[model samples]
Target: MKSLSLLNKLKDYLKPIREIIYGLTLHEMDLETKKARGNLDQLFMLVVFGDLVGLPLLPPYYSMRLLPYIIPSLERWKRSVLRERDLTDFVSTDL
Candidate 1:
């Protein structure tokens, strides 16, 4: 069962990416395991593309491939983290 879940597949798919993400992000992340697991997309965008929603130069095909599996989290992640306008958003909510 674990083998089929997209999250687990993503772990295997992007193992190298994990290393890159952890190295580039703020050390304050304190990435033991679960935190890193939860924030994979954030780390990818931060470390590789430096964008939030979409990358201007990167092709959409890659994202398209991973999109289905991460859909549930993506929706919430976009709403809570990516959709917010600016720094003013921080103190406005529980985020």
Candidate 2:
């Protein structure tokens, strides 16, 4: 019982230190990577389905071939592509 309690105490003590280390070393990189991935996904969607929004780059035959795989995110991609943005939208995310 005492050993279990000591182990619990040790874990509680180490938890914040572990989180601090992770925050200091890995958090910013993780956020940047996620941001990059989102940008890439949006760009890829634009390439694949831009016709729906009137900026057709790829030919229709290929877009039709890929339609099934892209269906789930189609609405979200359209909304994201068509939404209005301002300078503050870009500036605030960096901070």
* Candidate with the greatest TM-score versus the true structure: 2
- lDDT by residue for model 1 (1-95), tens: 76579787787869888777877784445544656665676665443342234554445666556556656665565565656476774443322
lDDT (Cα) of model 2: 0.87
- Over the full model, what C-alpha lDDT does candidate 1 score relative to the true structure? 0.57
Tell me the whole-model lDDT of each prediction, alpha carbons only. 0.57, 0.87
Pairs with backbone N, CA or C atoms under 3 Å apart (clashes), candidate 1: none
The regions of model 1 sitting more than 4 angstroms off are 1-31, 45-54, 79-95
TM-scores for candidates 1 onward, in order: 0.33, 0.76
Candidate whose lDDT is highest: 2
- Residue 24 displacement in candidate 2 (angstroms): 0.4
User: What's the lDDT for residue 90 in model 1?
Assistant: 42
Error of 2 at 92 (Å): 5.8
